[model samples]
Target: MNRTLIITGKGKVSATPDIVYIRFPILVNDVHYATAVKGLDGIVASLRNCITTNGINKNELKTSDFRVNTQTKWNDNTKEYEFSKFEAHHDLLLQLPFDTELINNTTNDIVKLERNIEFQISFGVKDSTIYKQLLIENAISDAKKSAAIIAHASDIKLKEILNINYSFSEITFRSDLNYSYDSCLMETNEKIMPDLNPDAIDVNESITITWRIEN
Candidate 1:
């Protein structure tokens, strides 16, 4: 039988996020289907204008999902679900470079749309491939050093790399903020800046390597 040794190496890379992802959800409810959809369209138009004013390109704002569903309410008197209204949901996603001022400005403007807009903000890096490569480098170096130390201590020689295996894991830096204003429009002249500061995102990777040993 061939003698072999296996080692699992782990690595992590942490850095400040360079990109910001904003998700806007617009929900409109009306008894009439057509009215609900029309309301959604008008609300979307207002939303587009608000973000564009903050220097965000119209093209960057993409619709992730749009659907209309019939909502029903349970009635105790009828002992059955009653037709309530049609609900229209529009989910939009936008990616932009990380900027505290931009986040503050856009959110403040969204409130002025006079519609209840529930939005979320998250952080990410633009170049994921670069980060992954650096992560792999670190993992491989760690594995080699570990193998060398084991070989020296055991008085065994590492002949060759028998096998190398690596797998990718999602490196998510979710500083997601889910917030919404009351149905009432924000009526104020002074800007209400939120206290927002995100910590560095840590991306981790791991790999396993097998080395043939000679004794």
Candidate 2:
């Protein structure tokens, strides 16, 4: 007969976020396709100008979503559906360092380019590849420690590990509150700033390890 000891171990590490992301969509609607495209081009150019003038890197800017669609709508006067109007959308995402002063100034400048443009801001870490490796090491260590403790109590020796499985939990780097460009511009005297401070994000890892047990 074969015998084995199975145990699951959990490890966690917390770190502060180092970067922030701002996402906005530029929507244009016009009766003619040419007009809609032209409007989109102008808004996109203005967006690029604002980002460049604020010292934000061009590589950090990304176009996430872009689409041009034509649809039909009811026309009471014509007594028939019309498909002359065109709608275009350009979604832009901006990444920048986590600086209160810089973010405030950049956002103010961006709003000046277009007041009606709606934007949302979120915070997160720039890269977690190294941190993930560290967490895996910690989790393996924890699994070994647990197996050793069990083996000692049973007066048995733990052999080579038969199987190992590890998974990471979902992490939240931003708070529940949403940042709005129009809302921030509403405040006259006070320079409105979003709640940029986010609590430490926990990097949680779990390992399910199986090892052979011997007498």
Off by over 4 Å in 1: 170-190
lDDT of 2 by residue, 47-141 (tens): 77777887877667799999999978889998999896788988989888889888898777766654355688877777777667777778888
Steric clashes per prediction: 0, 0
Model 1 error, position 164 (Å): 1.0
Please give the TM-score that candidate 1 achieves against the real structure.
0.88
- Model 1, position 189, has a per-residue lDDT of 43
Candidate 1 lDDT (Cα, whole model)?
Answer: 0.81
Which candidate tops TM-score? Answer: 1
Looking at model 1, which ten-residue stretch has the lowest summed lDDT? Answer: 176-185
lDDT of candidate 2 vs native?
0.77
Give Cα-based local distance difference scores for all models.
0.81, 0.77
Instruction: Check candidate 2 and list the clashing pairs.
Output: none
Model 1: lDDT of residue 50: 87
